[model samples]
Target chain A: MTGAVMNPAWALLAPVVLGVLALAGAALNGVFVARAEGRPALSGAARPVLEVMRLMRQRRRVTVAADRLLWRIGGMALLVIALLKTAVIPLGPWILADISVGIVWFNAMDVMVWAGMWLIGWGANSAHALAGGYRFLAQAVSYELPLMFALVTPAVAAHSLRVSEVVDAQQDLWFVVWMPVAFLVFCGSVLAFSAWGPFATAAGADIAGGILTEVSGVDRLLIMAGRYALLATGAAFAVALFLGGGSGPLLPDWLWTIVKTLVLLAGFIAVSRRLSAIRPDRLAEVAWIVVLPLALLQTLVVSIIVAVRG
Target chain B: MLSIIVFSALAIIAVASGIAVFRVDSMARATYALAVSFVAVGVMLVMFDLDYIGVITILMMVMEMAIMAIYMIMFMGMNPALMPMSMVHNNRWSAILATGIFLLLAAGALLVPWPARSGTAAPDLTVAVGEALMGSKMLVMLTVSPILFATIVAALVLANPRGRYDRWGDNLKRVCPDDPQQGGLGK
Candidate 1:
């Protein structure tokens, strides 16, 4: 199936759709939290809506000598990066901006999180916030290489960097079936970049919310929304790269895309809750020595298979 | 017409932010201003259909700048990097040098006897560019990269204070390596 670039007018819908998916992820996360705390699931699902309303009314917390411009920009950049990522991700047969280097485009956007998270911490001018920012960069140093290798595996298999071609290559056999290591590494890196679940040390409670220490009101709202949006975007990308995007029976292609993304997103949220936070310092050795090599091996295996098939 | 407008806008941003790198007081701001300048240049490359190079430029520059800002702040003596501080020093001579270089480059651009295009553009500019850069030297490229990586790994191993002997035992017979901090693996 040829993936056609949709009308430019549909570009506006990217953020709206991303926002909805993010809301669903948040609701799923809320459900997990509710079950853990022994609360009603329905109420937990509606909690994000109430949170938005509450945060909208709350006053923004201003820090002494804070770089407000950078702080605000950092908070807002996450959601913008998520939306930019969505541009390269096709929903079934339709895409926005069908660039030839879509995989690299997504990689570029994810790397922006390094700058964004650091600025969020640095801008607050608070000790904890700055520390949180540094922690994220440290964690990033470990995860970034593995993530890049994982992305390269799919591109190597498809012999194309375009998202549509990657999806098309998976029509016969899902890449996830053979490249489980890359798939797992991709999922883990998505969590790491989003600073969610086990990788949430950058915003850990021990550091008094870390990069989130000084933010409040709409600033806090934006950062929180950005985190969920990144998670949703990562899940959608994983579907396209590994799950054979829109290749399911009975349902239309677009619907299948949505369904697969939701399922993966839910898995992400639930799994994150199950695992405890990993300290960045501790993670560095394991990531580099173990995870990175595994990821590289996965890429090597995929490349060999592709070469053999050809 | 639209391409012209976009190109001009990006060029302006690149220059403005490049200037901002020295104008900004804080190290973080200066570092990110440089990042913005690079990002603008990267987008301009994308406009020229160098998609892979363009996107990789944005990826590398942002990551480099982020790390650089951290080191700049962390290693700065007297904590001046975190405080309000000038991003420039010896500014007068530097300005003169910068202007001299700019004029030279601009003159070269304007005066160079550039030949008119003789061949059609390739179907994929990324592949074309890659072939142009590496087609003949593919063996050298592949060989040198591994040696370079090996050197880096070797250097790090030698420099590491807590090597395997230190972590494990001198005889390398420890059940759990004695360490200052526990790793995620717990092994």
Candidate 2:
């Protein structure tokens, strides 16, 4: 139902590609973070996978008050959301589940991150961990409105909520140039939802790694992997939504999609290095007062432009 | 046959989780149980090809429960390792009320005739909903948005115990509220 539909087998390959991309992005983020802390970049790059090995060998530690069932659920939920979110983006011309409501699907999948983060926090039953969970919920409330507004702007410009349709609409004029505010808000919210860099308040170092403090062993590895996957998938979605998907001259569309995603992912990693973690409470106020209004205005402006053009 | 299998599996899950919501002792488990129930309903909707609405249902319910979990943690938080605590209250009344509502709903489902399939399920239901909202019912749809804003304002007021007066103090000279945590504009 999309342009230049390809063999369905590519769907199988998409996950592998996404996994590698997410790992690479995580490595890049590690390097940036390492450099900022005056550490060796090589170790930083290898850290995510290395941590997985270390965590695998380590015995699982459970807090006595911790809800074991919910903890595992929380850890699994993150990876599930990441995978679900990836299913929406068109890797080439088609995706695993190219549903008509692909944009909404992306949003829906992302909403699962809320449960994932909170469950892990609440599961730990520790003060710091619980606080981390609470922080993420507050942040989610603050950023969700702006994020929804930003997401809707592209749908308005494209005249469709489908990701492929949005990409198709951007063939002429990219939404980023016109919907700049929405793009900015989208980036900010993406960082927030993924708990990356500046928006990493939920897992900040202050409360002893926040929700992550009590988690150890394979559980920690899974959560970290899920987080990297979330970050990478979000970057991919940004490419599809704002950077005009695979639309570019002198290259295959799929290649362009990959390149754009990598660039955006690298930018995210670098940007996170430059900014310190935002305080969740302060962020809540700013989100409602500044970002939400700005995002709404962007949507209004885009809707008007679309109306006028039509 | 396939539809029957899928719907049966989904219905069983939904009902099981619904029962688990009350049966689960810990607050977190209860919240997740409710989430699981809602997710099952969402999946059932997807089975009917209502992708947009189903997905939205799943998203909204998960986020809602996650928020609920946070609130539970904030107020009644203790060591999870220490003891498993029961969160259910007004159990007898709740059970009776739930049973009554369930019976009423079941009666309606059995007594009332469900409408026959209409127009081959429309190729794209999302577009139809959008057109219905933006095309004819735009005014009604636009009017309801303020309710959401009202809810947000109301929630913020209720959640924040410290009022503006409490924060500013009597003289109104303090640049920042002396929140125990500190770190705002002043910091």
Candidate 3:
């Protein structure tokens, strides 16, 4: 694979591309929901558009003594953070920032979600929202370390933190083939951070929507879109970091990137739909005791291989 | 010109939000205001071309503040944190101490005779930074990190109210450890 192409003009396209991908993911999720209900798949696929329109027309809800400033910031930050994450991700050869610490940059952006989700919970001055926020943090503490090690595996194997270099290093064999444990952990972390699948307890119905309990209209719209966007971005980054990015037959590099992202994203949505939500307190033990060690061992194995090759 | 403008703007933001941390009445606001200040400083670090340090600073600081906010709210007496309570305490000494330290730092920054750039920068500053900081001390760092981690684990274990004895019967014959909350793993 060739080196990344840097152009400021391409930066403007990042959000537009992410939005489309997010929309597609949402539609896939809608289709899954419809299928479960024994309804037509096509109508379920169109549900996101309808939901967007319905939400646009819905009135904004305000709770008593809400911290409007922090609440609005929290609501809006997710989509913005998702957009920021895409800056470091290269679509085939085209990239926006191409910073030296692309992997860390992505990590930093995801970390912002902790603040955003919490603020959404805290700003409402409601019990459920606050409980939801705390749940997210609890879940985050478990997934984050394993995720960090998973991220480090590729960077260590490539001997560089640069995302493009990671893609280039995979010309021989994809990191996913050797680092399956890390990839699985990374995918699980993505789901956890996005608050999808078993990690959706933060917004679980038990807490009356948790962080989403009080949001309405545009605020609700933004948070929902942001979740899907985050899922899409995570899938895209997984492609670049593990799957040989844009390395495929017939299709162009950029198309390959999109194809891989969508496929993985659909898999995520389907798997999340199939699984039940795991309580944060219960998840803590399994994540630390089981997942963390496996991820660490995977990294250790990758490190040994890299050292031996050298 | 653009770089200078951006730097100045970030400096102003850092200072302003640092002040906001003290001034804000709400605990969440105060915590996030401090976060904003650190993020601005982290951005400034990026401007200085320490991309790894800068980004890591942002990541670590934000995560810390998020957890801190929870502890602040949880521990604050009578739930004053939820209410619009005064963020400051022992105002007089704190103000004096803050002013004194700020002045001392400012004075040191201005008075210190800084060394001039003697050679061109390394091609990869991240690698250069790692080598400069860790080359000779790699063994020490590697050893120290595990010791620190073990210390933390030991501390938590000591401080924990519930231990194996508390969970299981003293005879250790129970099939399941009796607990108020069930863990994901059946054991």
Candidate 4:
């Protein structure tokens, strides 16, 4: 009876607890990032997007020109897709829906970010919103290449697209230690994907809050919440990919896992803040020509290293 | 029971937001709606027992949206969700393609023969995952780190119009307040 009872429960424990913890990790990471950059820290950095949601709930204003349906859809889609990707990630020993092509699936789901943003911008019908939408396409085009390359590097090195396999491959040596260059590139891409500073060309004050300018009330809140959750998730990937994910001394596997995730997130926020003064166009250019090539080179080096070691 | 409740709630939220992805009026609203949908999905995935994947889903999407929003603000110079614009330029074709793809994917999901467990499961899944990573796959990751650094440099070179000298003045001696000829931020 105990065996049967424990089995399912144990199976469930890994996914759910770690999932929540991972969410928590991103917030913690952002807080550290903010603090490192001499910005104000809050308990809510553990949940950086609460303010946006609060603001949203407080109002429900809509411009007359916006497409009613698409406007509502954009915010909603962003959050759901972000969450769906998390279902495949493995924390410590637990995973849900571990597909053979888990990596590809994860990437495919992420493309929704691009689609949703475009829809949002186009639907809003405002000139500025349209421009912001176009900027997203441009930035996505540039950063995605390097990001994909960086993501594939791990699969190539591991000889499997399964994230679990990729993680398994890292036991002897954290990929970050061995492939420092790839690590850096992956980190950069994560930042780009997250729209952290230096690369935050789209949504700053200069852009009048970017694509979200027209959004008021609860819709705005949902989007903001989605952003925080996304931030947390991205940071967790960094931990999983390069860092020896959840590998540490003494602490329970879950606690260590959270700690590692927070560290990566802090690093991202710090980088984002550091690049605050830089222009977005400059950032985009660097991501494409420079970062992409470096990522390719990193892949080559890893292939060579594996070839020689094998 | 708690797990069931949590997951059910998450699933409902995810599905609701997923619908909203296409239901909203403005671009910004759609973005937010989609974000909420993803968050709910991520949470639901956590309930599904894939912590790493679920967490990453949240992180990657957040950053992606942030960049998207940044672009929206910078270029549009207005709120993206407030205006009524036609996002579905080629609606009929897109619908057909989307439906076709969904059907094919669903078919695969249902029909494909999945691999059964071959070996005994590891007691500690995390450690097992760790072993697989370092045991063989470290090389691929090894190569990509420098690629990221190079990207940083390239972004700087391509994006910035001026160099260090432009900002600091010619001699690095003083700020030229009157210099309208600055190339980068200094100008």
Taking every candidate in turn, the Cα RMSD to the unseen true structure, in Å, is 2.6, 4.3, 2.6, 12.2
**What TM-score would every model get versus the actual structure?**
0.93, 0.85, 0.93, 0.59
- Chain A TM-score across all models, in listed order: 0.99, 0.95, 0.98, 0.84
Question: Model 4: per-residue lDDT, tens digit, A183-237?
Answer: 7776766665555566555555677767776776777666655655566666666
lDDT tens digits, residues B67-177, model 3?
999888878758658898778899899889989999999999999999999999999987999999999999999999999999999999999999888788898777888
* CAPRI-style quality class for the chain A–B interface of candidate 3: high
TM-score of 3: 0.93
List model 1 lDDT by residue over B1-187, tens digit each: 9999999999999999999988989888899999999999999999997888999999999999999998888776577588988888898999899999999999999999999999999998879999999999999999999999999999999899899998889999888988888876756
Fnat of every candidate, listed in order: 0.89, 0.64, 0.89, 0.02
| Residue-level lDDT for A78 in candidate 1 | 94
Candidate 2 positional error at B183, Å? 8.4
Segments in model 4 whose C-alpha atoms lie over 4 Å from true places: A1-53, A277-280, B1-187
lDDT of 4 at B24: 56
Q: How would you encode candidate 2's per-residue C-alpha lDDT over A32-120 as one tens digit per residue?
A: 77887899999899987887789999998868767888888887878778877877888657666667788888888788888889888
DockQ of each: 0.76, 0.51, 0.83, 0.06
Worst 10 residues of 4 chain A by lDDT: A1-10
TM-score between candidate 1 and the true structure: 0.93
Higher-DockQ candidate among 2 and 3? 3
Whole-structure CA lDDT of model 3: 0.93
In candidate 3, the second chain superimposes onto the true chain B with a TM-score of 0.79
